[model samples]
Each structure stands twice: as C-alpha cells, then as structure tokens.
Target: MELSQEELRKKFTDLSQNPFQQTKFSRNTKIRKIIKEFANFSQEKLRLENKAVKIAGRIINRIRRFGELTFADLADQSGVVQLKVVRNKDFARVSSGDIIGITGKICKTDLQEEKNKQELSIEIEEFIVLAKCQQTLPDTAHYKLKDTEERFRKRYLDLLVNTENRDILITRHKIIQSIRQFLDQKEFIEIETPILVSEASGAQAKPFITRHNKLHRDFHLRIATEIPLKKLLVGGFEKVYEIGRIFRNEGIDARHNPEFTTIEVYQAYENSEHMMNLTEKLLHYLAKEILKKEEFEFNSHNISLKENFRKMSMIAAIKEHINLDFSQVNNLEQALELAKKHNLRLEKFQKSIGQVILAFFEEYVEKKLVQPTFIYDYPIEVSPLAKNKAENKDIADRFELYIGGLEFANGYSELNDPIEQKKRFEEQTKQKELGNEEIASFDKEFLEALEYGMPPAGGLGIGIDRLIMLFTEQNSIKEVIAFPQLKSKTEEK
Candidate 1:
C-alpha cells in the first residue's frame, strides 16, 4: 500500500519519539581511531574479548536485515564504520541519515559478499536515535547533490552528501589557523578594524553604503582595511595585519565576489621589496609547511611554490607578451595612437598616458602570468597609494602577485608624504569628476593621520578566497567560499 506524503510525515514523527536515549556520549571513541587500533582483530577475536565501545554518528546506509542480523553504515566527521544490530525491535523504524548513538563491540564482518571481505565493523548491543532525517536524501552509494545551484543554496545538504566539500572547509580552518600561528611567530600584531567607514578610500571598487538613523549620516562598508591599518602605522605599531571581511560593490564571477575576506599586512621601515619577499615566504609556508603540498593546479596551470617566483616590470610584462614596449612612447599623443592601434576602449578619465599604459597592460599581459610572477613598477595612475619612483614619477613602486593567471596579492612601498598623498587624492578626485566611479575617496581623516608623520612602510593584501582556491585545487571562487551570494529561485526562473 502507498502511503501519502502527510502519512509518511506522521509516521516519521511518531517513530522519532523512541525511548532509547542518552544525554551525551560519556566515553565515545572515533571510528577512525577504532579502525586503526583494531584492523588485525578478527570476528572470532572480538567475540572472545567482548570489549564494548560507544560511538555516535549519522547513518549513511539504510538498515538491512539478512537472516535476522541487521547492518548499516554510520559516519562521523572522522570516518565511516559499519554497524550490526541483532533483534532490536526499534531498529525497523530507524532510517538512513538519522543521528544515532550505538554501544557496540569491534569485529570483522564475515559476510558472503567479497566486498565485505573481513571488513572491520562493530556489533551493536544498544542503540538510540539522536535525530531523525525528516526529508529524503540522495542515494548513499555515491551520495551527491545533482544540481550545482541547489548545492550552493542548501550547503548543509551538499556538505552531508559530498566529502570533498567538507574537506575543503576543514582545510580552510587549518589554513587560517596556520596563518595566525605564522604571523604571530613573526611578532606581527593582528588588529581589528571597523567595517563601517566614512570613506571608501582603499582600492578601486564601488562601496556599499548604508544609512545610520540615529547619527543621521551615511556610512560605507569598508572596501579595504588599508586606511585604518596605515593609521596604526602612524600611531607607532611597527607590524600590523588585519584578516577580516571586505565589501565591494563589484561584479561576481568565477574569480570575483561582492563580499570576500582579505588579509592586509603593513610593516613600518620596510620597502616594497621586503614585502614581496615576505609574500613569497608566507605562500611557501602555507603550501609546504602547513598543507604539505608543493604544487597546485589552479585555472588549468600547475603552479609550484618551490621555485623562486619571477619578477617583471608592468611595461616589461606587456612588452614580453605582445612585443610592444611603451618606454619609447614619450607623450599622450603617441599613447593615444598606440591605444587606437590596439583597439583599446578608453573612458574620459582613462585618456592620460599612464592610464593608457595600464589599459595596454590589462589587455596584453595579465592572463599570460600563469606561474607565480610579481609585476612591479605599476603605472602611477592605477596605484594611488604606492610611492612614486624617484627616476620617473609616471610609475609607482607597486607589485601584484599573480598565479594561475589570477591576481592573488598586491604589495607596495607606502607613500608617507602627506602632500604627495593629497596630490594623488586630488588626481583621483579629478578622475572621479571625469566619470570614473571606482576612484579612491579623498579620505580627510587618513590624510590627517599621514600629516602627523607616519613612518615609511610596506603593505600587502591577499585575497583569502583566491588563495584557498589555489590550495584546494578548486577552479571557482564559489567552491572555496562557504556561502557565495546567489540569485533567488524566483529571480532565477
């Protein structure tokens, strides 16, 4: 007889009120430990010893009765173990995906199937349902969610069904913990910065704004932790770093997210060269020491951290890629001709020679950086916070780390001169007036801090999600992020 949907719900609810109960595991052992400790023990040995153990996990397989003996697979965070129950009356009502506590003895299964050929298992003496699985689950044979959109929408279900997803999140935790340990060992102080700010003056990104009812003011979610952290440099913190959320009103793609995490580190009395070395050491530590990995597959490129990274100037990189060196181009008219030759589209604010060089670099050079490469001496128009080179003010002492053709980290020698910084801010303001919405804000407070005499420093920022994507060998930013923003189902339809 076919039971209706409501009937099935009622039946499950009634069966969920089972009397077999334990408040918590007083002496529970992990299945991983058990398997490793008793792999040699046979069924005869386990029966003779009769040493009992208690374990609790979610059921991964439906209970099956063969010749009055019941069996199922139970899985915890550690691993999975097979469960055997004999003559348990309540066992009939137990379902797959239910959380259960079992008092059992370790043994090896002697089932007829060769697949169960003396596999280590446990014989249950008593069991209780901790939680019932109300909804149906995907098949346990190869438990997996079918739709990619649904997997992101219901992350719990995805995590339950996919072991890889669970491992990725676990690796995320370990990587962060290892980073904290690494930085702390280097005498770097981790500081907390405010999420809401009066100015979004950090990077070239649109800011998310919110209204404050009580203060009768508008505030922007911080696009970067650059300003406040640099303020700490003025306050005499020699080494400071911030690992927190950053908000940017930006487009979402495989490599980009609207909301993401970044770690910005600033060290006084250091130059961009020192920060570049630090960036390399940090990534090496993460790959070799922490993750026990020397190579990564990201964006179809096999990147090795063991090799010394390549360094090239931005103009040099563009020249190497397309054989067009901009060093000889002396003025704006020549740059405009080159831009027209390359079919480069330019906005009103992008008409300057430096901006045109940047447009050429983006068009010709960026994607060719497959391995770990640092493109330094960026055009001044694109690097507002970086110090200008003494020889030529057209370029700044800025470097961006690229791996797998993706931008991973950025570092630069800090511009300590308040007057020069104000000039840069004025330039940005002029660009904004000329129809560039992503220009850095003229942060009066940050300028005030710079005026109070900040020491010369080096600063670096890493996109945490992109770093994890490389470490985890995942291609999409969404795979590494726990919950990426998604369109609503109604909107999707």
Candidate 2:
C-alpha cells in the first residue's frame, strides 16, 4: 500500500522518529528478491499473505472500496502492482506518495475494463511505514514534462514516471552494444583518446574552452576523435575505433548537441568506397540484431534494409532535387540567389559557393532523402581532411549517409599529405580570422604525425544517439539521452 506524505509524517511523529532520515536499505535489490520469491511461490499456488515481507514503494494512486476490497496502486522501478487493503484497520496510515510496504497474498485478477487482461494483486494482511515522503508529487495522469529545461534538471523523476522515456534510453544502450559487437566481429580494436588537449584539431568545429588551475594555462576540449584515431593507424593498428564523447561549442537542436557521443573508426589501406560498404553492413547488421527486423517506419516513411541504398554525387543531388544547374551557379552571387529562391536562411558572412550549396542541401535535399542514401564527392573547400577525387579535382572523396531525412554517418578517404594538410590548415586559419567559428584550427602535432608516413586509410563517424533514436522511433534526441544539457535556473529571466 502507498502512503501520503502527511500520513507518513504523522506516523513518524507518533513513533518519535524523523521521517526524512536516509536509510541503508537498497530498494532495487530488495524488490528484485521479493519478485523472485513471489514468482517461485506463485508456481505452486501457495498463499503469500503471511509469508511475504513488507514490500515498499511510492503510492501511485488510491481507489475507493469496490464490492468488498479497497484498491491502491503502488509502483517501483521493477513494475506496478495493485494492492487490496482491508477496511477499518489503520487505513488512515496510508496516503499517496508515501513509502509503505504491505505483506499480502499474491493473486491474479481479471481486469476486464483495463487494457491488460490479467493483473497482479496483493491481498494486504499487514503493513509497515518504511520511510515518510515529505513532498507532494505532481499528478501523473496528465503529466506535463513540457519544459525541456526542467526535464533535464529532473531526469530521474521523468524516467520514474514515464515508461516510454526509460525505454528509449535502454534502447540506446542496446544500439551501442550492437555497434561494438559489429565492429569487434570486423576485427576493430576499441581505443581511448585524451579529452584535454593542448591543440584541438581534426574537424571544423569550435571547441569548448577550459582552464587548468595547476598549469596556469588555457586548454580546449577535443572537438573530434579524428586526429588521434589516425595517429593510432600510424602506430600500426590496422583497425581501431573509439566510441567517446566529443565536445563542440555549437548551437543545440534536435540533431545537434554541445557534447555528444561519436564512433570513429579507421581502417588501414582502404579507401572511402570500402568504408561505404562497411558502413552499410554495420548499420544493417545493427538494425537486424538489435531490433530483430530489417523494416521500420520513421515519421511516416517506410525504410527497408533489404533494398540497396541510393548513391548520388553532391552536384547530381542538387540538380535533381533543387532543379538548378550547378555548372552555371559556380560563384557566390549565383549560389546566394538560388538559396534565396529555395527560402534557405543564409548569413551575410556565409555568402560562399560551398556554404550556399550546403544551405540548399539542408533546405531541399535532406528532407526528401527518406531512404538510406550516400551523397558523395563534396566540394573541396568544405572538406579539408578528405582526399581529393582522382577524376574530379574540385570534389573530395567524402560521403554522408542519410536515412529517414537525417545524416547517420560520414566517411571519407583520409588526406595523408603533410604539405597539402598544412596548406588546408592555413586556409582554415584564414576563415577563422573571418569569424567562421567552425573552421578547423592548425595543430602542429597532427601535421608532424602526418609527416611520419601514415598509411592510406578510410575513416568514418556515426552519431550514436541519433542512430538509437532511429531504431527506437523517437523524434527528439533528448528522448534517447538519459541526461541532456539544460540551462541553469539562474539563467532564466
């Protein structure tokens, strides 16, 4: 039976004890033992009224006596169960949200009106006040976790009340496990890299600034695992992957988080084409193993893993989707006019051909890409770390895998020339000076590692959170993450 805060406090006061004191008993462990014992006893049709110990959890709700027995709903992490309390026996001791345990018989009830046909019931014979609740709980029937900020602040409460929210996070764990198993089968060794770095390099993303108290120097959080993972390749590890957190000081959205998990894998002596095949197989395998099906729906779109994914060049996609000829729209002015025609938002400083192309793709092509598609051969200006295509010098050997209108993974043939890397870094430095915060910074150590003769390799990164969201059929990234970032209460106006 559940007890209310007021009832528990009154009981504690009557017993000459404080209700808010912490206890050493772990509820989760005790509950599991109780479940096991009950399951065993139920197999033999044994009455558990006297044998069962006081099982305690927060009271969910209470219903008046119907016919002969009074019903109370109680819940813990394991699951919810109905409790039948006999009338005229210290019933005032129980209230909503109070922690109480009832020693009762384990019986089944025919819940004809409810969704579940069979319901577990406890015929209460005795009870104990475990701990008194001090605060009143909000009404859970019409629960309002509307404020995204508060949802993060009280994630434990949110998970306790919402089963779907809990399920999403559990699905994320399964997806990550499937990913590790898939890579392990492909002979990939998992490795770790430093989060604190003297110089942040690898991708064109801004880093979170931090200070060292003892060293009296400023450092940046590693924005990407690209450079270190490549260094592992140079160190003679044929296949390696790192599933770790990467920090980027950027805007927050459904697809973007300031701190997120990224899986970076590098295969030595392979090109982007090989990585594409590996990417497809790994994702398909994860879907099959984790979800136990190759077909699923995302936002009304039917996706099938059995069908071959569409592969298209960036220019080809733009021409086909936007109905514009990229051959004529080669300059910034022409590109900006096309972006305006498509109603894609473009900043004044972003008036470049590459930036405009990206804007156009985001507005038109991305939403239309319902199935798995690899849009490859990106413009060289935006792909500094990728190798240039042999046949097309203007484009790089980079491909982004999109499914259900969301980019799932990105892969490229890694650029290994030290001189060319240095030149690209210089160009990025110039862009940084122009107030482009996402430009990659020059890392002398990375350049030095490149000069040490790294092998030809293909690298890929998958957003683990987003992939989990896809499999779980959740629309928001926050739904999959157990605890996402939120602004402090003090920051609110």
Candidate 3:
C-alpha cells in the first residue's frame, strides 16, 4: 500500500529523530571485496562460513516478502550483494533506495536450483537504517532514466539508476590513472599551474574572465596549460606536465565544452618529433596495455593504434583531399581567389595565404582523417605559439593527432627565441584589430620568461575529455563529462 504524504513525512521524521545505533557497521567490508575474498558462492565451495560480516549499502530493490522471510539487494560503490533477513519488522519498514547497515554471514540460498544455479546471500542478524529514502522508487521494470537532458541535469539519479553510465565514469577514472602511471614511468614530473592568469596567451582560443576583488583587475581562466608549463621549462625543469581543467569561452557542441580537461607535457631538449613519438607511445600503451585492444570502433570507423600513425603536412593533406596544391599559390590574391572558388569564408585578417590554407584544411581534410594520423606543419597564421619550420617559414613545426575525424592531441616544436615569440604575440594582437576576434594577448611576462634562455623544448597538449570519449566510445562530449554545462532555463525557451 502507498503511504500518504503526511504518513511518509512522519515516518521519516521519526526515523531521523530516533535512528538506531550503527556502531557495528563502522568496519563494514565493501561488497566487492567481500565477494572477492570468498571467491565461490557455489554450494561446493562455500569456503569458511564461520566469520560474521558487517556490510552497509542502500537497498536498491523492492524488499521481497514471503511470509516472514525478506530478501533485498544491497548496493555500494564496489558493487551489489544480496541480503536475506527473516522475521524482522525493522526490515519491513525499509523501502528501495533506503541505506541500511546489516550484520550478516555468507550462506547458500535455500531456494532450489534453477538450471543448476543457486545463489549465495547474506543472512542478516542485526540491522540499522543509516538513512531513509523518503520518496518511493520507480518500479524496477521501468527504472531507466530515458531523457537525455534529464539524465545530464539530474546526474546523481542517472548514476544511481543506470549502472552502465556509472561504469563509464569508473572507466574514465581508470584511464586517468593509467595515464599518470604511463607518464610517471617515463620520468615526467606532474606540476600544477594556475587556473586564473593575467593573460590567456596559451592557445588561439577565447577565455572565461572573472574579476579579482583585491587586485581590482580582471583575470582569465586558462584556455590551455601551454604557457605556464612552458615557463616551467624556463624555470629549469627538464620534463614537466600538468593535468588540469582548461576553460574556453566557446560554442558548446558534440566535441566542445566550456570547461574541459587537458594534459600538457613539455620535455626540454626535445623537438616536435620527440613529442610526436611520446604521444604515439602513450596512446599505444593505453590501447595495448590498459584497454587491451589494438582496434576500437568510434564514429563508425575502426581506428587502429597498432601501427606507427601516418604523418602528413597540412598542404599535403589539402592536396590529397581537395586536389588543390597550396604550394603553387604564390600570392595573397591567389589564396583569396582559391577561397572564393571553394566558397570558404575569410575574414579581413584571414586573407593571408597561411589562413587560407588552414580554412581549406578544416573544410576538406579533417573528416577524411578517420584513422590514426599525425597532420603536421600547420599554417603559421593559425599557430602563433608553435615554432615555424626552418625550411618553410610559412608553416609551423606542429602536429595534431586525429582519430575518427576528431582531433585528439596537438604537439609542436617550441619557439625558444624571445624575439620571434615576441613578434608572434605582437602579430596576434594586430590580427585581433583586423577582425580576428580570437587571438592571444601580448604576454610581456611570458616573453620575459622566454628571454631567460629557456631550453628548446617540445610541448604536447591532449584533451583528456576527448580522449576519454574516444576510449569509452561515446559520441557526445556530454556523455563522458560528469556535469557538462547546459542551456540556462531562460535560453531553453
């Protein structure tokens, strides 16, 4: 029988005001560890049944009643276990989702074997309601939280009901753990950089801004960990990395989020080639060792991390995809003509040959890079922080790893020359004046850091969220992120 609102409120108030003592459950074993310790639950391998166990978890199912006998499934983070209680009036008051503490013993079920499968369960001796779940739970047959927006909005309920989604988060934790292990084994020191900064000059992206009350000036959330991490190279750290949150004020899409995670690694005395190799090794290690799979299906493409990733220059990729040779384009006029021919939108500042090539690459080549690939030598106009190629000054010595048509990692040969870096920053500011709204500020402090004889280093940045999405085979970025930013109530209309 369903209880009235007043009755439910009174029951919860009484329980909260006079709860039972739970001192015995202070040392309760996790459900997962308990299952593992007593390996087999079969009648033949019941192992030692002498020891009593204390366990605590929320009742996640309807308390099945057969006369005086009661059965419920208790769940904790480790996993779930069955509970068997007989002739207990206290257990009768508890409903699904109510947290309970139980003192029990591992015992084989008295139920007859159905196709040779009888279960092991915990037979409760003592019990306490740790907390009461006031509201009634959804019927077990229709427990899934089906609305996508609702799932994201009320993530706690989603995780509580959907075990599969919860496991995705678990796998995300494992992937991050594996990354730390891999980097630690390679002798990389993990360091923390500031989330708020005076200048957001790392990557070519807009930043979220907030005011500092004491300083009386605005600060920007870091769009990338590139600048401060590279400053560590200036501070004499040989191999340094940072794994933290990055904020970008951009349009949220299937792959983009306002706040996301990135792992930026910089190694002194190394160039883009070395970082490229490290990126490949890291991904390979994660696939072959961590995930234990050489091939994964993402976006309907079977991406293979087994072989050495294919490498191509930006111009080469454009030529291959659109069959237009950027190398043959001699002047800005010719580039503009090509842009017009291809129906590419070019702002006033983006009329340069380099920007035109970048526009072409994005429109033509990115989606076709369905397998593991390293597209290097990005356009100099678009790569302000990356070093320009010695042979081709118009191209930056940079590489971006792509899999299943999405960019996974970006690495480059760092520019140690203070004069060139200063020039790049100045040019970025100038570009902003000419209608390129997304450009880095002229960071005088970072330029000063570069002037102190920083080592020629290789720097790499990988979007940790996107990597998790790829590994977990989730199409949308919101699926992997725990609490993705959503549209406001006002905007929904």
Top candidate when judged by TM-score against the true structure: 1
lDDT of 3 by residue, 334-384 (tens): 999988888988778886888888888888789999988999999887888
TM-score preference between candidates 1 and 3, better one: 1
**TM-score result, candidate 3:** 0.94
Ranking by TM-score: 1, 3, 2
Looking at model 1, residue 265 earns an lDDT score of 97
**Angstrom error at residue 315, model 1:** 1.0
| Residue-by-residue lDDT tens digits, candidate 1, 1-493 | 4457897677556664543344565546898998888878867887797878998889885667887788899999988989877887678788787788889888878766675468788888887777767677666676678798899999888888887898998888888888888899999999999999999988989999999999999999999999999999999899999999999998888898899999999999999999999999999999976669787677888888889999999888988999888888989999999888889888999978889988888777788899899999888888999998889888899999999888999999999998999999998999999999998789999988999999999999999999889899998888888999887899889
lDDT of 1 at 410: 96
TM-scores, in order shown? 0.95, 0.84, 0.94
Total clashing pairs in model 1:
0
> Clashing residue pairs, candidate 2?
3-95, 3-98, 4-95
lDDT for predicted candidate 3 compared with the true structure: 0.85
How high a TM-score does candidate 2 get?
0.84
Between candidates 2 and 3, name the one with more favorable TM-score.
3
